[model samples]
Target chain A: MSCLDTIADYGLRSIGIGERVLPRGDGIGLCEQFTLIGSGLIWNVYFGALALLFGFVFATALALAKASPRAALRKPAEWFVFVFRGSPLFIQFFVTYEALVLLPQGGLHLGGLTIPTGWVTSAWSGALFVLFLNTSAYAAEIFYGALRAVPKGDLEAADAYGLTGWARFRRVVWPTMLRLAWPAYTNEAIFLFHATTLVFFSSFPAYQQRGDALYYAKYFADKTFDPFIPYPIAAFYFVLVTLTIIGIFGVINRRLNRHLPQAARPRLRIRPQLIR
Target chain B: MFLSCADPSALSGLNWLICYLTTDKQLMFYGSFLVVLLLLVVVAPVALAFGFGGALAARSGFWPLRMLGKTYTAMVRGIPDVIFFLFVPIALDQGLEYMRHKVLCPDWTAPIRQGNDFLVCPAAKLPPTDASPFYQESYGFVLAVIAFAIVFGAFAANVISGAMNAVPRAQLETAEAYGMTPGQVRRRVLIPQMWTYALPGLSNLWMILIKATPLLYMLGIEDIVYWARELGATKSKIYAYPHPDWRLWYFLGLLVFYLLLTRVSEVVLKRLSARLARGQATMAGEALRKVGA
Candidate 1:
């Protein structure tokens, strides 16, 4: 079969579009591999993007809470970060899924209402929640470090100008913290994106065998008994997306550092070792 | 493991719990934690050696060697490590078997890869198929360790190379001026001074390596995750210990174990960093000198 035909059939297969079922039986084509795996990229983008978008605000709050002087506020925040950061994310998914599964199978009881607990065991909800918390912890640590490293002079300037409390934080402290944090935060973001590939591999079973890029890649590898092709294809897709992440974050990093002199601005260096 | 606890069906309360935890499989489960620790201990020095070699290669005067070294460090940057974790072992296994097949089965004419099957001669099979289960399991484990070492060696090379560069040029120059050979300068000055700079990155890598141990489950090795899942599943009444799904509890135990490991490692790494920092020209060393004075 032509590559275009394969693309037409399997292009949106990951989202259950085009082909109603995945290709099977003898001799799976290159086009099927590319198209189905490419289709799987959709779920990866979904998990990474949504988790990161939601995790950012939570992380910001968490970082501030961790940096807060009040012990009550600080202690929980610190514990949350430590718990999530200290453990393997793979275990987190397993534990969360198992815990969610043990919730009353008939759903939660409320006054004249029932909250469905069954969905919590599915990848869409449970895995995403795990990813959300995991990224929040990592990003929170990065942000907390930047919060501490924010120039003392910047806060002093804000104080000297009589900007206090919320106004001071908004006008001076927050932006500077973000600017300082952007580089390491970029690394965290990239790692979190890479981590989303683990969702289906953990406890959360991919309903209907629908899964992320790595899942389909593993599927093809299993079928073909050829690790050479499918795995590298997945790796290629990941590298492309990783580069795109760097590009997008690079633009944001430039914007964050724009007010500073070029020489003073911190460049986003790709520290490969920062990943978990 | 108490003598009275052998009959799990008769047990109840604390006795039942004791019997349940003392199963042979549970003992293996406990032993798997040591497997993780062993991987960390073994992989660290081996990966450090790989990293040192790569860093030195990247600094080599030879162009092809430098390119190979640069590629080693750069390849891990853009790809998800789990991909490598999955890929490296299988690829390495196939590669080794393919080489063996070439050497051992020259008379055979059938294709090594016939359709989806990787058909190597029996002699070429890793552990030779007739080998003991212990040998097979150990072979699988060693492959997993090598995968970890290779992937992490790239990260370590990145760290070590940066540390090598961070060592001031003037020190090397002074050594060179004293008529020291390039290798002698590297041994006497560059290598010794790079540790302080490398400590923070290496410590970070150690924490990362700790967190990555669970991926061994993916490689089909019976690591802690495997044991947790195996032990935690609900068993029927036909089994010795009938229970509802207790995976949550098992996982919770694993989580606490990891947290404790991370905390202990943090304390130890801090001390190591301080020790490495002594007499160095860095800020930490300066602070130590002030305290001593």
Candidate 2:
């Protein structure tokens, strides 16, 4: 069939939109691969975007908790970050899947409430939850470092200007911490999206053959027995997504550094956020 | 593991636990941890060697060689590393077989990419079709190691090259003015000084390497994850010490093992970093000098 036909049939295939059965055997072509894999890109974007959006709030709280002077608050946040960051994402997926299965098999025995837990094992929620926690841990570390590095003069100015407590944090501390953390946080965000590829590939089930871009890429590779084509195609889509992430984050980075002079603005560097 | 552990069915309570843990498969499961350690030990130095080569190539005056190194270092930036981990081993295996096919079956005329199959000659088959299982497994393992080395080598090269560049221009120029050759200066001044700059990045890489050892499972090596899944699955009435799915427990144990492993490494690397930082012209060294004074 033509590439247009392939796109029409498989464009929304990953979310169970257009086609059900994937092209197999001799019928698989480059058009089908591109369409299906691009379809799968939706799931990656779904997981990455949602996890990052939710993770930012938790990560900010985590950074604040970690930076808190109180031992009770600090210790738990510290341990949380340590546990999540210390293990490989691959193993975390495994452990989290297994725990999700076993932990709440029946229902929670609250005083009068019963909460079912089967939904936690599905790829959408379960994998997203894990990615959420994972990104929070890494981002919290980055933010914590930036929180520590917030300029002394900024805080002094806040104190002198009668900005105290929540107002002080909102006006002076939070913005500067974010400005300092933006570059590293941008790297963290990029890698967080990249880590979405690990979800279906790991323990979680992609019910109804619906999975992320890498899943479709691997499917094509396995079908064709040629790693050369599908992987590079997936890489191309990923590079596009990555460039988009850089562009979006660059805009935010510019906004964060807007108050400072151009020369003083710390340019975002896409270093390897290779730490688990 | 114990004299009385053979009759595991008769055991109960702590005894049953002990017997189950001491099973032959458990021993191999324990042995697989060493395979992980071996991968780390082997892959680190090899990757560092590859890194050094890439770093040198990046530092080269020639544009083509510089481009080659730049591309190698840049490969990991946009792409998910798992793609490389998956692709590299198969690609390397096929590449090797293709070369061997050219040499071993010079008279063969069939296309290598026949339809969906890679049609290498029988003689060019990896581990030879009739080879022992042990040989085949080891060959697969060596290929996995090489793949890890290649990808991580790029990461290390990025780190090392940045560290090389981070060494102040004044120091290198001072060496140049002292009549030191480029090679001599690199060996004496650049290499020695770069370590302090490289240590933080290298140490971070070391942790990443530790975490990535688990990806050995993806390459189909029967590492700890493989064993955890195998041993922790539900056992029926047919087996001694039958139990329900305990993979969660097995994985939790793995979590603790890794946490401890990383915690210990962090402590040791902290001490090592202090030693490396001594007498350097960096912040840590300056702090050391103040304390020493």
Candidate 3:
């Protein structure tokens, strides 16, 4: 078949479009491999984007709570970050899935209403939750560092301007903290995107084998017994996604540092050395 | 295991739990934690050596060696490590077997890649078919360790190379003024001074290494994850320990184990970092001097 035809059939295969069944047996051509794996990128984007969206707010709150003087608020936040960051994300997925599986089957009933808990065992909700928590912990640590590093002069300026409490935080401290944290948070986002690949491999089964990019890539590699093609294709897709993340984060980073002199603005450089 | 543990059906309550936890498989499950530590102990120094070589090569005057080192360090940047975890072991195994095929079974007529199959002479098979299970497991394990070493080595190389660059240029110049050769300067000045900078990154790598131990299950090593799943599955009445799925508990135990490992390592690393920072011409060193005075 032509490459275009393969794309037409398998392009949305990961999301249960075009093809109901994946390509099997012989004639697992390059086009099919590319199309299906590209299709799988949809899930990776889904897991990453949703987790990141939710994780950001929670992480900000966590950072604030951790930085708070109140021990009651601070201790729980500290422990949350510690527990999440202390363990392997792989273990988190396994533990979360297993725990979710043990939850009362079917749905929780309140009066006439039934809130389904079964979906929590699925990769979509379960793995996303794990990813969200994991990213929050890492990002919180970064933000906490940034929170601490927010200049004393900035706080003094806020006080001098009679900007008290929440006004002071919103006007001065929060912006400075965000500016300081942006680079590290960008790194966290990239890592989180990379981490989406782990979802299918973990305890949560990829229903009907509709999985992320790495899953399809693994499928092709297993079938062909050739690691060269599919793996690189997956890596290519990841690199593209990672660069896109950097680009998007870079734009936001610029806005954060826009008030500062051009030379003083911290450029978003991808620090590849740190892998959590 | 206790002598009474043989009659698992008779046991109940705490005794039943004890018997279940003390099963022969559970013993192996506990032993697998050691395998993880062993991987860390073995891989850290090996990876450090690989990283050291890579840093040296990257710093080399020769173009080809420098290019090779740069590539090695840069390779891990784009890709998720799980890909390497999955790819490296199979690739290394095949590469080894293929080499054995070429050298040991030169007379073999058939192509190694016959359609989808990777055919090799029986003699070329790693831990050949007739080999003992222990040898086969060991072979699999060694391959897993190598995979870890290769990936982590690249990370270490990045850290080491950065640390090497962070060393004060003045120190190297002083060594040169003292009539030391480049090699002597590198050995005497560059390497020692680089450690304080390298310690933070290396310590972080050690924590990551701890977390990555669970991926050993994916390599089919029967590591902690594998044992948790195996032991925690719902057991029928026909089995000695009849129970619903206890995987949640098993995994919880694994989580606590990792948390403790990370916690202990953090303490140790913090102390090590402080120790390394002493007498260095840096903020930490200056702070230490102030405290001492």
The TM-scores of all predictions, comma-separated, are 0.98, 0.98, 0.98
The segments of candidate 1 whose C-alpha lies over 4 angstroms from its true place after superposition are: none
State residue A192's C-alpha deviation in candidate 1, in Å. Answer: 0.6
- Using DockQ as the measure, name the better of candidate 1 and candidate 3: 1
Q: Which CAPRI category fits model 2?
A: medium
> What are the runs in model 3 whose C-alpha is more than 4 Å off?
A273-275
lDDT of each: 0.90, 0.90, 0.90
What is candidate 2's DockQ? Answer: 0.74
Classified by CAPRI criteria, candidate 3 counts as medium
| Candidate 3 B-chain TM-score | 0.98
Predictions ranked by TM-score, top down?
1, 2, 3
In the range A1-276, model 2's lDDT, one tens digit per residue, is 789988998999898888789899888888888889999999999999999999999999999999999999999999999999898888899999998888667877788888887788999999999999999999999999999999899989999999999999998999999999998898888888888898887789888999899999889888888999889989999899999999999999899888888799888888885737
lDDT of 1 by residue, B1-293 (tens): 67997788888999899888898888999999999999999999999999999999999999999999999998888889999999999999999999999999899889988777888988899867889999999999999999999989999999999999999888899999999999999999999999999999999999999999999999999999999999999988998889988899999999999999999999999999999989988899999999999
**lDDT (10s digit) by residue, model 3, range B175-208:** 9999999999999999999999999889888988
As a TM-score, model 1 comes out at 0.98
Question: Judged by lDDT against the true structure, how good is candidate 2?
Answer: 0.90
DockQ head-to-head 1 vs 2, winner: 1
